[model samples]
Target: MTSPSDGTLVAEPRTDAWEFGDFAYGLEPLTMPPVGDATVSSALVPSALPPCNPDLVLFRLRLLAEGGTPDLPDTFTDPTDDQLFWFRWITGHQISFLIWHLMGEILERNTDREIPDRASLARLETYAYGYCAMLLYTGSCPIDLYQSLIRPRMYLQHRSFSGTWASDFVPVRGLFRGRGVARGDAPEAAGLARAVDVHKTIHDGIAARLVPEGRSLLQQTMKETVVRPSERTAILYDNFFMTLRAPVDGEGITSQLLRRLDAVASDVAARGLYPLGYGGDERPKELRSAEVAHCENRIGHLLHEVGEAAATPAKPLS
Candidate 1:
């Protein structure tokens, strides 16, 4: 994880990690030609449409096409820390992880209409490993218990919560369920149904929105609780999007962007938070504390270059 004083990342050859070069040209194309209803054989003529925001139409099309083969970020070279964080965050929010979890749940419950994509079934195990790593990093409850408590709670939250994107999909979901009624004959109805499934799959796999116990512990512990002599509390604000907008370089922005997480983890430990029975500890109390300490150390070492890297976008690769 150590980098030169100039803040240039060592750029270790990684067999298991994704390099920046891999995704250099992988962004989904933004422009989409006018599309007709899924059932319509003909494409819609753009000019024939009434005056409306063409930008919005393009945006929706782009959003639908955003899902590509998921891969780790280029900066994920160090296994000790970067991979841990990447794995944790991906399983918690990534679409790949969500769909996989939902399919597994449906199979386990032996629900009807359980159409399994045997080809993609392996992704479930991959995400499960990441999910387990996330639990360990966040010091959350045991995997099974966390799933039991979190899934149903999140399912309800997805329906009722208005602030999140999940809530916006509720109408579409209802439309899907009632497709046999008014829209049954529409050509696009099947596409709408698939969209509904994708929407629910993502909502069901959210690990960030935990059960009451997990949420309470995380919220309380993540606050600026550890007041330093300088009166600074350990708080790691999410600057990910902003950091993304900023220029990136070969030196790697993660070295500076996520540096605060170390302090946050330290603060959580210093406040004696490890032994709390929030999600139920599978390991002995001592081992749990040790793991927390280890997680924090790994986070600290992750992308730990000697110099500070400015938030900047990288130039196009030659």
Candidate 2:
């Protein structure tokens, strides 16, 4: 097994890796797409989207069925450190593909069906945290690269492509705003509420660091009209993450989520989250530490908590 000590992450299979099919009822991959590939980025085009968000859990299942390999950049085994830097950012977005849709499922069930037990909600929280962790990795890209390449590509999608306009997430905005069924007799609800707030906070911090000018996305885009949440915006969000839309079973969603989660955990463990190192001086003081060691430590900690929450929710998080 290739330990993380040397930081040469060729990626070996983990012995303790979990098979989500055995316990598919619960929980998330790590890879990047080919650079400058117009074909894979079709989610940004209005003509490419479905009338509504496709069941993302199904999309994941389809990927697994096709040999469990998601899209990849031209080079995987070896790339210059500079190229790997951007690869991490792209991989971060790729992993986030599942996190966004899974949260929507949790919110829908809370409002429409029997309230979920704490364990289930807690497991859901791990996915939410995984989303936050993805945001962190995205910001790991240097500001110069982000502005020169990443920001411009996003502009091609929409002038004001804000997170608030994700169609599936629009109905649940109150939860992040502290107006949802967070408290009352449901402690799990409150925990989820907290996770949402944290996710937003981290998002804001990342934006500030990456775009220190403090310009709103709208301001940056130089557009005044706020795009409403609809199929358009939903597709735009998925396009940014390069998620594919496909139909799959509702019950299969849980199994697929768990499968995706294990793949990501195994991949990151084998190759530390920010293998090149935390973008030094670019990272925020509150989160950056030990140069590179801090982020590697954090990656292990966050994923471990998420895995524990999904695999053994009966136990308390450490």
Candidate 3:
């Protein structure tokens, strides 16, 4: 890939694995076959099992990727102000913002437009479905769920006056056009719809695991927020490209981000799982950790692909 650096175009070689789809099932959880000698199933090891069903992973991932406020389960007990805040933070704005940032970055790289600063690229809209599909199919980041404001949420700040700012969203109705989706639909339109579906599933799954009060609280919150029907895709392709402006070490920025994300996920599982208690059925903890890790891996993999593609130099004709 090529990019201008001090008036010189720098190029990097591309890898066979440097594609968004390459990471779709990159880090699936392993299910071990029972072993006779060790009594420990190989399933416990992530690498032991074959890759997960790409279709199902993609399905569950759709839920995890596009999280929102309405996805929460019903509330059983009243939430403390702090708990409510965290719940909101986890289920909505922050996660949506991060996904937008990633999608924007991809669009910017492909179109040579500054995505963060502009709105609605007529040119990129044609490829919107394909791009949106790839992002939904490949984008995942568990760490983003726990945090608020991944990229300052400023990209769409100016567009807030336009139709409720990411509300009233309707999913692509079906695989065919007029089913809530058409060939010309904006990327974010289809993107947000899938996000809502996935978010709802996640809340339901979590609520089922928690105690009665916990489940009730989640359910209550879930019902409180209602998404209005959206007229068009809320955020559109822009020309402004985003930059971290942070110093890059020996490894590239993508590598650094992945490393940091890995650490964050590890720390979360290490501290978060303690409540489950030692020897208190590690399966749930392991499964949760693996799932979170999978999401982190998908994000890291996509970023690496985007970074490389952005830097790819034009090849000379033979």
Best by lDDT: 2
User: Which ten-residue region of model 2 has the weakest summed lDDT?
Assistant: 30-39
Q: What lDDT does each candidate get?
A: 0.28, 0.50, 0.28
In model 1, the runs with Cα more than 4 Å from the true position are 1-17, 21-78, 87-185, 205-238, 242-318
Clashes of each: 7, 4, 34
**lDDT per residue (tens digit) for residues 215-241 in model 3:** 332233346654332322232211111
Q: For candidate 2, what is the lDDT?
A: 0.50
Q: What ordering of candidates by TM-score runs from best to worst?
A: 2, 3, 1
- lDDT by residue for model 2 (49-106), tens: 1111124323433343333543332333444444544545554555454454455556
Write model 1 residue lDDT over 1-318, tens digit each, in one string.
346897644434324212222221111101111111101212332111111222332232233223222233455333323333333332223222222223333233333323323322232222222222333444333344445543344334332221112211222233334343113244433433433333333233323334424343324433645322110110011111011112222222222222222222222232222233443353434333543444333432221211111112222222
